[model samples]
Target: MKAELEQLKIEAFQLLNRAQDSSAVDALEIDLLGRRGKLSTLLARIPELPVEERSGIGTLASSIRKELQDAIVAKRGQFSAPTSQSLDFDPTWPGHSPSIGHLHPVTAFLERSADFFASLGYTIADGPEVETATNNFDRLNIPANHPARDLWDTYYLNPARAGLLLRTHTSPVQVRYMDSHKPPVYIISPGRVYRHEATDASHDTNFTQLEGLAIDRDLHLTDLLGTLEAFLKHTFGKVKVQVRPSFFPFVEPGVELHMSCLLCGGKGCSACKQTGWLEMLGAGMVHPTVLKNMHVDPAKFSGFAFGIGVERMTMLLHGIPDVRLLLSGDQRFLEQFHY
Candidate 1:
């Protein structure tokens, strides 16, 4: 019986060493130490043996059971240890490419355009999207019954409020800035503007506009023209600019600034409507009415103001066929600008 017990100890040790994983080790433990297992059976049969022999065999069995339990625990530790590295993720394996994002084309253009102005000592100014008719139109010399007001085609928030309307342009920012700051003010107001216009290939109900105002002593139209020409060159990179007679109620003499078709290099093209020029922005000296409304003496301080459509600028720069694409939020259209 003693020899059999010794052999069982050797067999248990061999089986424990052969267990490939924790599950196999658990199975072996149940086979050797469970209620119907050899160690349990031996412990149960002890009462039938002589007292002296029973004590010796029971002690040996208890020691062997303890040894087997320790071995199983140690083997489980070994099994678990290797799993972390065994199911090893190859360090060199290609990982999933993370989705990257970028600024919208309009936004990129806005930043670049803003930086260009900033470099020339122009600071940024902003105003509310919801504005009073007085600021949006009246102060700019568009009277209540003036036909020029029709050109804006405004979106009024409350007709009863009479003058409260969504701003049609960022020119209101110019008025607001001048109202707060004295002359020698150079500012570019870049923001979203709302209109009630029907959407088309060239128009959008919601768009962005950048309005620039420079007020100081002795500023003239030539200064305006030269500044605009430098800005256009910086923006479009070596392009011809043309200023034609135009009128806006806010200015005594306003002009439409145009840049040569960048796509066709000034040659006629569909993009330029075969004219070889694209109307870029509008500029004029600050109207007396506008200056008077802001309490700035128009005679003492002459200044120029210009408004440029950011969407149009972005569209021309990126060769986008439709202006609507700027606000479409379509991934396919936008992904092309990803850095």
Candidate 2:
């Protein structure tokens, strides 16, 4: 029994040294130390051995198990050590360049328009695109059964709530500003507006509008026309302008301002539909009823208001044919305006 134990110890040591990896070492451990293994078998046979020899044999088996465990841990570290060469970066190589972004055409136009107004002593004002019916319609002198309400063609956020709608124009900002501030107000509201309508080459259901409002002791229709003329001349560089009578519910004695078609230089052309003129903006004296609604005394504080389509101005300025292209997000269409 002593000779058999010595032979098993030598064989186990040889197997442990031959193990090339942690997995092989684990298999060897199971073979020698498992419940049905050689070590376990020897331990199980202790009762068959003389009682004096059992203690010494058990001690030897435990010593062998400890040695095998230590060898496995040491071999695992050596097997996992990285053998590949380290990389060194070359400082002389050119680095990658990150892309730089520019403003979109619509955004560029808005900035330019804001700058133009700011130069005229008109501070920029803003309002919520999601607005109530009173601000969007009623406060602007648009009554429930009025035809002007149909013209707004608004996008309602919630119909059952009676008046929550996406604003049809930035004119609502004028009402809000009046409600909050006293007269001698000079503000240009520039923002996105929504409508429910079929899109065409010239029209978009969603577009931008810049509405200007100026209320003081003695504002008039002439002051409104003069301001628009100055803006158009500054914007288009010495362009010709003409105003024709028009109608709007919020403004009394409204007129549609027209500039000679930039594309054809006032000569008949396809851009102006052969009329030699392009309607640009709508301007008029602030209606008494509109002021009365906002608690402003129209008799003491008369004013003028105008609304211009930002997309139209951009198209006229850049000679863009389709309004849809402005909002389409097409890379090819946008790349042309890169500056």
Candidate 3:
């Protein structure tokens, strides 16, 4: 019986050393140590022997099973494939370069635009995209019955609440700010605005607008023009701006501000509709009634306000032909803007 136990251990080690994979080692373990296996069969035979001889044979079988299990475990390790680092690695070797990501083009432009205004003593302010008709229109001199409200053609969130809706412009932030603050307020509100409009190369249903509002004892159209000029020059590097008479309910004597097409340098081009000029933003002195609606005495304080379309500015600066490209998730288009 002791000789049989020694032979079992030798057979288990030979099979374990020849194991090509973990599965072969597992099979060998069951053949050698499992119930009814060689070691277990020998242990079972011990019960039929005399008590003194039974103890010796049982001890030898247990020892043989233990040694076989250890050999199987060690052999399984030898069959495992080496890790990549263990097989081929140098401590001084240059590592694989990882690709880094950057901000979206619109976000990049928004931050730079805010920075330009922030440098000019304007504090950035924000308000909700979902707004009330009173703040968006009534407080902006565009009542429910007013024709100017048609110009916005907005998206209504609820039929109740005097027409709760996604704000058509960032001007509501100006109204919200004035409702809580007094005169000498300087704020620039940059936010997403919604309009119920058809998508085109030039227009999008959703876009960004940066609204500027500054109120003081005396603020004039000249101040508004000068501010717009400085902003345009700083943003576009010395571009010509043209302001023409326009109409907007929120501001009196509203004017449309334009810049020479950066693509054409004022020469006729398809992007500018062969006109060589791009309408950049709208600006004017705050209407007295709009101030009165905010409960700020219009007679004591006057201000200038302008709303600049951020996407339009991005298009002009980057020479992007389609406004849709700004909203498109095409990585090729977006990856061009690294900084």
Candidate 4:
């Protein structure tokens, strides 16, 4: 038994010295020192020997086990020792550059439209998103119970004190502007509006509107045409414009303005429904009743007003197929509009 113990001690030391890596060291430790190991098996036989022999063999076995454990630990540490003389890192490698951002397409378009009108001597006007029912409807000549009111179906706010609701259109700003300022009033109102309508590819319950009003003595439809023509040219880059007769409660002889189909170039296409023109906005001479309601004498002062859907124009100009994308916060869709 003593001879076997001596043989094991020599074998274990040789294996531990030859161990080249951490895994090899681990195997050596398990085989030499673990439970059920060769040394343990040999030691277990000691209890069966003569009672006088047990103490000597047991002491030798314990001494051999401790020596092998120390050697195994030393082997593991050797593998983990640092290979370098000092700590260091390469300084020449390039670093990451952060991304740059620009305005959203809708906001960019709004600013350009405002700047264009400002250049034409039209001061920008603004009004509250929550407004009295009178300025939103009646003052614009759309009185309650009037059939024309049916056309502007909107979300009426709850707790209807002061008949307040989210402004259905920016036209209310023009009414507010006219009430305070006298003619020759030249102003454009650009703002967000709310409607109680269902959303589809082209419509949203919440969207933006830009309305323009120009009031002065002897203003005619021709002046409206010329100003809009220059604006269309400036905006869409030399597109043809057409005005067809339509009706609105606020504008007598109201006209729906159309721009040449950018996709088909006025030759007829699905986008324009074979008409070669896309309806852009509604405009006309201000109704005399609206003028008189605002305290502008219709006999002396005449004007023109137009309301444009800013999102509709942005979608058209940018070839954005869905109106919801303007409001969608998806980074991939919005990244395409970044400058």
Candidate 4 per-residue lDDT, tens place, 20-86, comes to: 8999998888787789889988988987899998899999998998898888877797898654642
Each prediction's RMSD to truth: 6.4, 10.0, 6.6, 9.9
Return the TM-score for candidate 2, rounded to 2 decimals: 0.70
> What are the clashing pairs of model 3?
none
Give the CA lDDT, 0 to 100, for residue 59 in model 3.
Answer: 72
TM-score to true structure, per model: 0.73, 0.70, 0.72, 0.70
lDDT of 3 by residue, 15-127 (tens): 77787889988888788778867777777777788888987777777677777777877787687877785558777888999979999878888899899898989999999
Each candidate structure's count of clashing pairs = 0, 0, 0, 0
Candidate 4 regions with alpha-carbon error over 4 angstroms: 1-93, 159-162, 263-276
Clashing pairs in 2: none
Q: How many backbone clashes does candidate 4 have?
A: 0
Q: Rank the candidates by TM-score, best first.
A: 1, 3, 4, 2
What lDDT tens digits, residue by residue, belong to model 2 across residues 1-339?
A: 667777877898888788888788778778887778887887788889888998898788788777767876676656675544312455687897986667888889888888988988999889999999888888888888998888879677765787798999998898888778998989999999999998876678999999999999988888998899888877789887888899999899999998888877778665577788888899899999998887889879998999988888888899887789998989888878866
Model 1: pairs clashing at backbone N, Cα or C within 3 Å:
none
lDDT of model 1 at residue 102?
Answer: 92
Residue 61, candidate 3: Cα error in Å is 25
The candidate that wins on TM-score is 1
160 in model 1: Cα distance from truth in Å?
A: 3.1
